[model samples]
Target chain A: MNHTIDDQVLAIGIPTDLLSTTVESLRAEILPLFDDTALKYSQVGKVHLNLCAVNMIDSAGVNFLVGIIRACQTRKLGITVTVKSRFVHRTLLFLRIDRHVELVVAS
Target chain B: MRVVETHTSPGNILGVDDDGVARLVLDQYLSRSGFRPELATSVMHAQQIIEMRPPGYFDCVITDYQMPEKSGLDLLIWLRSKDPCLASIVIAGAGEKDLVAAALRNGANNYLDKPYRREDLEQAVNKAVETTRHRRELARNEADAAAVGHLQRHLLGGRNLAIPGKVHFSHHPKRTAGGDFLNVHPCPDGALLVLAADVSGHDLKAAFVSAYFQGIVRGMLEKSTPIDEVLSFFNHCLWSDWGDRSAVTLEMPTSLSLCAAVLPPGRGQATLFSAGFPDAQVVLPSGEIRPCGVGGGHPMGWFAEALPERKTVDVPESGWLVLWTDGLEDHARQLAVSPWGLAYTLLRRDESTARRASIGDAIDDILVVAVALGSASFDEGFPILADQYAGDRWREIDAIQNEWRNTLTLAIPALSEERLCEILICLREGMLNALKHGCKGRPECTASLRFQYQSKARNLRAWIDDPGPGHGFDWASHAYVAQRDLLPSHRGLSMMHHFASRIENHRHGASLTLDFHLPEPP
Candidate 1:
């Protein structure tokens, strides 16, 4: 599981490429970042997840991003996932991750 | 003629020779030898004779090494393969040492030379007859052992014992037959009696001891015997005997390791007696595991003075009492850790990513029993019990949703909508598996559900089980991140990981129990 997290707004960008093999590593890489910076979430009341560069995704990707959001809420922080791909949007809806995370469709 | 009374039935001998004269001579010789004889003119005739007779009709067979159509070596190979213990003698021509060797290699128990004297022929027959008698005795013993296993399995058929709180047990035998016995039943005063025993060996002797122990314990519990008295009865039964029938088993020096406890009905105090087995652990309601006792008592049956004494321990009202066999400690060693640590790791499930630890090549029978004491005990709420429901198709899922709502409304309406949704998702995924795998998507089969809420601790536990026989898969290999390479339909477990605190499956996936820690109310 391999992924690069580019944190801006000190934002943690989840892995863009999610091979099932790489998904776990991607999770491993990003979860600690969230854990360390969790205090920032209480200050803002919401955490933003960037899903723009994720060109292709599967059920695992949908659930992984969903889980990251869940992880955020598990820390008592609200999560807002910003996505531009209608594909990503629909995947979120189908997997029901949309119900848990606030989906901010980027223009 | 001296008949061996050891064999009540007449010994049936199969004699094979291509020459009619030799056959008649052998027939007359066997007749006077006090044995019944069946003669075949050739190896081929002997083969037909042996195959046509009722199984075990011929206790011994004698064949001429040199024959037309088929040789004695060929017949010996066939006969020995069908009954490896069949006593057989091959007759070789004079000075035919090589033929005699071949006959022995082909499974002849004895060999006689051609032109053999009556005494020599009788000597070979005597050895063959004795060997046949021994083989039959061994066969009968094996049959008797199988009967004991059958009766034990029949007694333990599809039985599930439900203790006050959440007590689930899963047993995997190293062999189809094993000596492991585990049971938990409430005493007349609401105190519980938990007996987990493992005898010395994996054979019927071991099973008999365990069955004997179960019977004694049952009788004493019926009479409302004290724990010390129960232990005394157990010890006495293992040491001395009550029913003279059990007296027979005590005649043999046998032993077993066990953890026997009488859990107080309301208070968290539990009296435990551990003998030569793993120390029982007390799991804090907070999920922290600590060893119950520093040391253990002696295993039953080695020394008369190795009497067991009572050691009392405190159990958390919301916590658990875990008892396991030595096999689990052995399993821990395979994982390169201490037994208690492995037990903790299993309970905490710290490595959600790795596969569940298994014994691998060093596998042994394992039993782990834990009792969380309380009557429908949780921090703040009782679990809404849902019995078996037909779960064959998707439309039926509506009934599950409705039931969940009813159970939730009746049980825990104060739960946040977000937490309720998470709980519902977990239920859906679990039942989906029960439907697809357990029920085979068949409309008639049913799956059951139970939901326990601990609002004080902000936790929810749901148990889902199905009636179908269980199956195994790679539970640890589930994908966490999504990708094209991800196996299709790799979503349920990942969903569970996201939504629940711990997802533990039992009975090879026929039952799934998940724990969820709810967030502080929004």
Candidate 2:
């Protein structure tokens, strides 16, 4: 469950299993970035979540994405989610999350 | 010529020796010691003599340790196979301890050393004879019990009464006999009285009580006695009669856990009374299973006022009424499988490879009865996954969800990834709601999830229940507002509504069912 966060563009890497067990740690890791005004407002006009390595996602993971989307909306920033799993892509589409964020299903 | 007494001997002994003088001495000594002795020149001769008599005719066999061709150890081994109840004593020379040990290990009860005193001979023969007698008595008792068990199974097998609907019942006893019993009595008004009970033990006494209880029910019901009155009488019989330790010789009082159902001829109200038994399930025509309303009460004999808790269930025109003994539920929980799934597995002709392993290791006497009401057809909903979660152990949710994922993929291979995702999402959301809101994160509180697949309807349904007094909330209104306002808070319910083909809530929202229609199997 390795993840990486790019400070320059505010791009966060999601682990392979985006479940309740992993979401909490991911949330903790990203909480400080939200506190830094320079990272949230100045350096990044948009937040990119690279979920290309994700194999599965549960409701908690979906709720995590929703939290990120809500945060981006409050800060007047756009967000995009990139995933390689068709299941995850379909889940996002099915839940109608694509209406708010640009979802890219990487081949 | 010595006058040998034929009667009043303690035991009949078979004495074997290759030496002629030794055989004569053994015969004389045994006769003088108040025992009947038959002399055999060799091991083969001893076998021939013993084979002519009944199994327990000769109480003990005294054989010389060393013999031509076949030794006494060989005779001891053969005697074990021929008559395990018969005991053997080996006569060995001094310093032949190894041979004596081999004879003892091979079924010789005791060994007599060469040049032994009359007391030593008598002591060895007496102990061996007593051992043989005890073993023979035990064998006789076991044979009798087995015969009775055979009769019980035969009688119970033919006890499936004629009812309006198609009755499918299965009983698997843990041993030759067990406590689990079922009887169906057809009433005068075309109603069927079905009783499934599990007596306390798995022995002959339990089987006897089970038969007696069924007979009482049959007699009382035939006399036009009210169901409640009949139950009351039976409870009193247990509490004051069988279960009373003061008069009964039983070490512990007998308690009977049972569930009785009165299913009408057609679609009507069905009466269910459960006394410390698992809840019966009603499988609707749509394949939705609803457990009996009455949970359970104290088992009969537990208290003087241990009345059966009664509940009325609306029977569908064409559905299934399922009843089972608690053994099925206990085993299902021990295996972490769905009780419904286990029942269906035991009922169906074909078994899944995954489930067959669990069925082979059943630890209880299982009985399941499923009656189709008012029709010949009932949708078979195969349960694939079932689990319970403590409200405080939410951290294990991911691992458990993955297990469900594996089971669903294996059970319904045609289930597309998209539909599986929908199921897992709804399951997590529903469980989270149950744990966080319903259970209020109490460690003692718990929630359960059951997933059933209806192959005929191509539908997968999830049933989730939490032990909580659920609050009133219009989920539809919340979903509508959440979707319209793009709110993140209550969108999980909206997602559930969107993904599931239908949603049903029961027990004041404590129980939730979500159904997703699957594509045609490829």
Candidate 3:
């Protein structure tokens, strides 16, 4: 398991089983960790968001990712997101938001 | 020094003061000025006296600015807010300069310290009342203007087609609302009634006449009135309405040129009715034109007593009916040719496939040309025939009528073998005439041919309308020579003359209407 946290950045790589439930629960639980730094780092520069975990993003999970992107932009932060799943890339393309974000494929 | 009557009515003025000096100094001044005044103990009593009387009962309000819970400013605000037109003056004993300014801004007609003379109060009351009357008049005029706009929109009916189909229609008024109206409505018998009318004049009066005709036509349609009866009823109603108005006084009589149709359900059949409008045509599938007969009645609403005759013809299937206002006819005539050029332009082919994609597409193409030619407006592309010269005008009318006849002639190929042969024979004669006579002067002179078959009547008509000056064959002289057996080459004319029922020279072209009773459908 790997976990990294900084002033406006969070990267997590948990076990596949833990990732399944954790990703679903993190939308509500993890949002508060960045609440304090949200206003501080919002106007500074681009915010790096990396999630390298056991992968598959459902419709609801995709919606959570979009919500985070919007919150970062409202505070004037550019976002760079990386996902390993082909499903996530397809969803981004389907939603037409892929053009606005940098989507990196995990090797 | 000088005393003025602050209140015109003696009963309205209360002379009570703070020291309980009722009628002491004020009454003496009022008596000297030849004016009587009423007395009140407090502000509450004075308000009660004013309320008991109707508006304008008191000439002025001269009250102390301070009294119990209600101060003079409060009374002034209440009076101005309620009437805004009420004339009043505020008199304050402990007059602070800022407080006096506040009282004036709060709508007190005038503000004065307690030591102020009676003449000052009287002047303020008169000025305030005069300003109020002027403001009220302006509001009344604005209200009247809004009402007129509302009425015009209601009369105009706005731009919305009642039913959607291959045809599109519109009418534009140059004024708030002009006398022109176009209506499309479903009749009780499942037929669609389409009417376009232009009433005399461009003002509200003309619009009223148009609105009246719209109602009458709709009513007649709802009652299942036949096509002819609808025109006749409108004629009768307009005559009755406009005749009485112009009879007693020498005034311009109101009238309308109406073109109306009742399109039956199915592909191409409609019962058309027109009054003093340019001739309408039925374009057959094969591209022959047939002129719809027009009655010799004056336009609707023109005469006190005139009977209109209506002609009915069974429009063949796979044909298009083109109706026009006089504007379109004039435009065609002005160009010194018939609308054949327009029809050809609209129905032009790529030479590879001489096929019309759709009836709707044809109408759209022609309309585009009409607009480009400045013969029509975007909203309603009815050709304006009045602007065209007489000689040029009739040619356009004949051309469009001929084109309509040609469309039917072209459609005959699908009807039956016998009918097809008859149509071909007529077309053959027209083609030969074009090759021989039309192209003689200038070998490059081109002529087009259209053949139509009337299935119901079992008749075939062909039109070889040409742009050339005309054939020098002298049709009448040839008929004479053929009768005398003098000319040898008169054989072709003799053959066409006997073969076709009628070969008529139209204003700018010629049309050949042939009667072919096809042997009977198996």
Candidate 4:
């Protein structure tokens, strides 16, 4: 996971797999960027996750995503996930994750 | 056709006159006009003179009307039959209107009256010479094209040696020389390799490039270079070498759509590699057709990174592997028929149908090759696609799902993109469920996936089998929990139920089958 902060928005690139073996490492890498103390004055109002590389998401991956949605809710920051794979998009929709975050199906 | 202009050098003329004085006068007039005139005493003498030289060597034939033995009209008719393009002029009597009309009707270039002025004779000779020059150029072009076509047919469409499978191909060029080309190579490992390719344009230059490509392939394959590596080398040559040259010299860059297949002896898998070519079709013994590759490969010479898509396809005993270029698909689309159907029909050589007639007049060049894998006949179902996955490597689910999507998409091209995604989602969820629960993430446990298409029933079926017994949970209850309560744990089960048309549990839930109804072929 790679994240860049610019213009009050944090953009993150998701890895290819969000499965049981790899989800915890991604969560560890991604969750801290949300609550960094130095960002208090930077005003990061939105979070954008680029899931273009991801195609499959198992239960552990879904739970990790739900945790991120909750983190954005607590911080009062809008969250959007961009994806190119239809499977990832449909999985997020089926899990009701779209209710908390904006989901974009990129062409 | 080149327009021939004989202004600088007046053409050769054959002058026929019974009167020795008239012959001398005609010869002197022709010499003044910068023309070489060969004088003949009569029509028989003119025929002997004309036959001695090659046709059209004597550009114009000038004969006096009402001559003894063969008349001027008779000479004009004979010259017309011998060389239809040879120019002929008839000298008629001043009062003979019927004779002048008959000479013109028998293919005379012009008519001259007896005691005609020198100017009239020179003007007729000038016009006749121009006609002869133009027609001769056209005749030469036709002869060249026909000869090139004969060479292409024997070189590119020659019969192949007897190999493990039955291989037959049909190539129809719209013009005498076409851009499409194909070649069959017998591999040293008791296998057959076939190549079907189409150059960018339908012209002689395109044919030349095609022949050049075949020569390169033959030379490289003789050294036992892998087909994929050969294609990669070609792509590099096109992108770096020809690419730069064509950019500087040609109005538009040339490209090629290529498809190559390797079929081994006996009941072995056939590997197909495609670059900007339509997917090859696999026809089972029961007349069931399944597409063999993922397709959508970038054509060679288009990009430096245009690597051909390679896929392993099962060819059962007594089955067929049909390969073709997009020219057939383009023509088949216009005819509102399946390309595979047209290709199969062509391979079988069925001429009683309208498709065969349409193929004869295709707008583009078409090349098709069909190989029968074995000689035995069997009437059982065979998996068009089959794969095995270890549960411990569950992280490869994405790659496995991608293969499934490609195979299904190629097998049933009629499947809409949206529907295809949904079906793939279902298969992915099922495989994940099997890997997690049934195999328990054990390295020793493996799961198998297979897809079969039944064209007669318009059905596509996928079966997923796991080593362990399936989980005993009620799928309906889990689906209800996901739908009603929005729980994340059972959401995949819900998605599978929503996407797959029907799901059947077999072998105490160890094996699961999914069926999808296909649309009628157009």
The TM-score between candidate 4 and the true structure equals 0.55
Kindly report which residue stretches of model 4 are placed more than 4 angstroms away from their true locations once superposed. A1-107, B1-9, B19-21, B54-56, B93-105, B112-120, B157-165, B244-250, B333-345, B348-360, B376-522
RMSD (Cα, Å) for all candidates, in order, is 17.4, 9.0, 26.3, 17.5
- Tell me how candidate 3 scores on lDDT: 0.51
For model 2 chain B, the run of ten residues with the poorest summed lDDT:
B1-10
Which candidate tops lDDT? Answer: 2
Q: Considering only N, C-alpha and C atoms within 3 Å, which residue pairs clash in candidate 4?
A: none
DockQ of 3: 0.01
Off by over 4 Å in 3: A1-107, B1-162, B227-229, B245-250, B266-269, B329-522
Poorest 10 consecutive residues by lDDT, candidate 3 chain B: B364-373
RMSD of 1: 17.4
B1-522 per-residue lDDT for model 2 (tens digits): 334334354999999999998988899889999998999998889989988987678989999989999999889889889999999888999999998888878888888889878888988888888888888777876876787678767766677734433777767666667788887888889888888889988777887888788789888988988788988998899888866456646366788988889977765789988888877878776555677776576688888888989888888886778888877787766655456666665665354633552544667778888887766342556455656788886767776676676657655656787678778877877888888877888889988888877778888888889988876777778765655556656556766777789998888878988888998856
Tens-place lDDT digits, model 4, residues B130-151: 8988888888877887777788
Which rank order by DockQ, best down to worst? 2, 4, 1, 3
Q: Which regions in candidate 2 have their CA more than 4 angstroms from the true location?
A: A1-107, B1-9, B93-105, B113-115, B161-165, B222-225, B239-252, B302-307, B349-364, B375-379, B382-391, B398-448, B455-522
Residue A28 CA displacement from its true place in model 3, Å: 97
- Candidate 1 chain B: minimum summed lDDT over ten consecutive residues — where? B345-354
lDDT of 4 at B193: 89
Candidate 1 residue lDDT tens string, B64-105: 888777888888888877777689998888889998987887
Model 3 lDDT tens row, A3-82? 35555455434333211124456665546634646446443355555645534333334445656666666666676776
Give candidate 4's iRMS in Å, 1 decimal.
3.8
**Candidate 2 residue-wise lDDT, A1-107, digit = tens:** 33334554568787657776788888887777666575645467778889998877776677778888888888777788899988788778866788889898888
